[model samples]
Target: MSALRSRKIKYFFILPSIIWVLAFTIFPLFYSLGLSFFKVRLGKPTHFVGLANFERIINDYKLVNSLKVTLLYVAITVTVQIVLGILLALLFHQETKGKSILRALMILPIFCTPVAVGYLGLTIFYEEGGPLNSFLMSLFGAKIPWLSHPTWAWVAVLLLDIWQWTPFCFLVILAGLQSLSEEIYDAAYIDSSSEWEIFRKIALPMIQPVVIIVLLLRLIESFKIFDVIFSLTGGGPGTATEVFSLYTYRTGLRFFDFGYASALSYLLLAIVMIIINLFFKRIRAVYE
Candidate 1:
């Protein structure tokens, strides 16, 4: 009886967390899943539509374009973040005076709110008299449109994402670097291995798991990028920066197409899941 009571008490302790997940996570997920199969619009009675919503999404031109843009954004941002982050991690990993201060400063951008970052990006990329253009004009007597031109607007969004997220990659890689076995490095040095060889042959292989984990996390987050694009460009300059999340938000909130929006969201979820599965498979292959 006492053992049963103790088990009950332990369950009581976890009840709140279970309830929270049920109410916020699991319930909403199921609700959205059901909603995706219905034709739900504001001021109209919802009707069962089976796979109609999914079919509509598959045929959606805006969704297709948003997918392309999102893929481009994710590819560019994640690649750049990984490369630059690894370089920065290596540079800052050395013990030097002021290294702590520099590391703290590096994380400031990541610590800022995404909405705040987006608004700050808006100011920086403002067309006529923004600081970037102003500096360029003063220096070269040329002002390139940063926010108004479609290509430049895409670049601005990309730049904002890179600035905000590169620090995350850097911090993760730095942690991996710091956790490395010092004795291994000592032995490598005793063997007269060059720094490049030490990193490429030893350090990188040891940190491969951390790097893969960071890439997966960033890829998932980058796919759901909405606040930054919403506030920075508003998917403007002719839908050039309309990512999947932003497109879904515009459809559901702005256009009141709940069913279709739900479908698009599920598609995004599926894409992320597929990418994560691939990463896991790669990790298994590497380890096995």
Candidate 2:
């Protein structure tokens, strides 16, 4: 009876969180799933459309372009963040003076809002009046079209992502680095293992799981990237930077095509799920 009472108390404590998840996350997700299947329009009854929305998505060129851009963005941003984060983590892990201060300073960017970062990027990269163009013209006497050019715009977006999220990746990797046993490194040092050898043979393997998780998180976040691009470029220069989220936003809110936008969102969700599944499968394979 005591055990039962304890379990019931535990359940009662957890009930709020479970209810919150159901109300916010699970319920909304199912609602979106239903939305994906229906022909939804503003101020009109939502009619069941079977797989019509899905079929429409298959034929939509804009959705296809958005998917491609989103996938590319995720691939590039996630790779860069992980690699740079690991490098920074390794550098900071060494014995140095003011290491704590450096770590605290590095974590500042992670705490910054994405919208603020986007605005900062704009301040730096905006044409005619931005710092970047001003510097270039003063130093080398050359004018660069950062916001005007498609390639430069994309590079700016990547730069913003790297600046904002690298800190997060650094924190995760640094935590992992800290958790690694010092005895292992001491033994490696006694064995006359080079720093490269130590990193490859000792550190890499120990941190692989954290790396995988960080990569997955970055990948997912990048796919949903909107605010940065929207604030920076508004997916302008002729759909050059229009990623999936931005595309769907334009479709639904700007164009008011709820059904098509819903279809695009569903397709985006499917792609995200597929990528997540692939990552898990790779992780499982490595573990096995």
Report the C-alpha lDDT of model 2 over 1-288, residue by residue, as the tens digit.
Answer: 134454568877999999999999888777777777778777242788988988987688877787788888888988999999999999989898999899899889888888888888888997886898889999999877888898888888998899899989999999999999999899999999899999999999999989988988888788889999999998977788899999999887887767767677777788888888988876677665
| Model 2 lDDT, full chain set | 0.86
Worst 10 residues of 2 by lDDT: 1-10
Work out the TM-score per prediction. Answer: 0.91, 0.89
List the lowest-lDDT window of 10 residues for candidate 1. Answer: 1-10
lDDT of 1 by residue, 35-127 (tens): 888887792537999999999976889889999999999999999999999999999888778988888898899989998899999889876
Candidate 1 stretches with Cα past 4 Å from truth are 1-6, 280-288
How many pairs of residues collide in each model?
0, 0
